[model samples]
Target: MREPLLRIEGLRTVFRIPGGEFAAVDGVDLEVPRGRTLGVVGESGCGKSVLSLSVMRLVPPPGRVAAGHVWLEGRDLLALPMEQMRQVRGSRVAMIFQEPMTSLNPVHSVGAQIVEAMRAHDPGASAAALKERAIEALRRVRIPAPERRFEEYPHQLSGGMRQRVMIAMALACSPRLLIADEPTTALDVTVQAQILDLLRELQAETGMSIILITHDLGVVAEMADEVAVMYAGRVVERAAARALFEDPQHPYTLGLLGSVPRLDEERERLLAIEGVVPPPFALPKGCRFHPRCPFAIEACRMAPPALEEIAPGHLAACIRAPVEQSVAA
Candidate 1:
């Protein structure tokens, strides 16, 4: 078997608050094979974004990676010094943030930003070659009038265009892994489809692994080969995309799927998972999701269930046994 491009084991990220240490991402493990997309899905504040930030070592001040290892192509990223990590960030693993408007520098032209990214990774390359590569990158992302848009600043471009520029910058060095955190959140449905298609095409062309962080199950259905379902700072379930969708083992995962609107089903009322995600500081004992889970039993209140493999390559933390299997079979 080919080695995975990125592997995260027992990853835990914590923030120091006035009260005490609060973990945002707790004991999460994930693996991404080369050229495959792994979708991390959960509601807001479920530590999806925090996990991405932790992977890039960009966790904000007061927040620190408390434990675990982040290995990229066999190199331990967390062990690398700041200078070395900086080199690895754009060259080996690039990230596309949720909002391009906030992510892109307002002062610099998009073209100049791409050129800078190119030069940063390959300082020995000539200016002419960098310019050509920048233009090619834009074109590869299907940014029309690449030459013209190259000179335009972030504000001058549409949301979609700015996103394209962000992707171009990320792919400037053909990084081994791309971390896209809600990359389509700010765009309209049409533009969202376009951007996702472009990303899929680019991934195919370059064979770069992608860690897509989003709450949108629709996007996950379309893009991911594997899926990780997170809840209250922990991964409750994980499996191949089709297997997860067809047989979600965790109650939280079931609730998430139930919430997604289906075209074939017409109902007067929409199904909603009741209650907001609990804050990290006030996490409940046992299963963090038990308070909201309809299937929560007495056992769910006393001890947190360890993540266990229920089937081949399918793991879930829920104590219940394959609830979706009889329904599907």
Candidate 2:
């Protein structure tokens, strides 16, 4: 088997609450194979975004990576010094944040921003060369009139255009790993398709691995090679995309897939997973998801279940995994 481009082991990111700290991302173990996309899917507050930020080491103040290793190409990122980590961020691993409006500076022109990103890694390069390279980056993402778009500020462009610019900047440094958090939020369906296609084309060209974090299971179905379903700060199920969609083992994964509006299936109403994700500080004592799991029994409330494999490369945390077999018996 080919070695994974990125490997995460027991990652935990904690935030300070009033009296103590709570782990927003708890004990996540994931691997993104070289040139393959790994989709992290879950509803709001499930710590999908925090997991991505933890990998980037960009968790805001009062939130820190309390434990675990983020191994990128065999190097432990969490162990790196601040300065070394800064150097690794843009040139080695880049992120496209959820909101381009806030992520992109309102003051700087898009071209200058891309140029700055490049200059960080290639400071000795002449200004003219960097500007040319930035414009080329815009063109690479299929932005029309690359020169004019380059000079425009973030607000001047349409939402789709801004997203393209974000993608362009992310790819500018030719990083090996790209973590995109909700790259298509608030865009129309047409534009969403375009951005996803652009990412696919770029991945094909560069052979770079992607960690795509989003709540849209539809997007994951179309883009991801593997899927990890998260709930209440932990991954509940992990499997290849087809295996997951065809035979989800965890109740939460079933709930998520059932909730998506399917064109072929007829239903009076969309299925919704009952109850909100529990607050990290006030998580349930046994299984974190037992409160909402329809299959919960007395045994489920006894202790947290381990993520165990029922079949090759398919893992679930629920005790009654291989749920169909368990249900049939």
Cα lDDT for residue 175, model 2? Answer: 92
lDDT of 1 by residue, 235-258 (tens): 999999999998778989888888
The segments of candidate 1 whose C-alpha lies over 4 angstroms from its true place after superposition are 324-329
Colliding pairs, model 1: none
Model 2, CA-based lDDT: 0.92
* lDDT, candidate 2, at 237: 95
- RMSD values, in order shown: 2.1, 1.0
lDDT of 2 by residue, 15-67 (tens): 99899999999999999999999999998889999999999999998999999
| TM-scores of all candidate predictions against the true structure | 0.96, 0.98
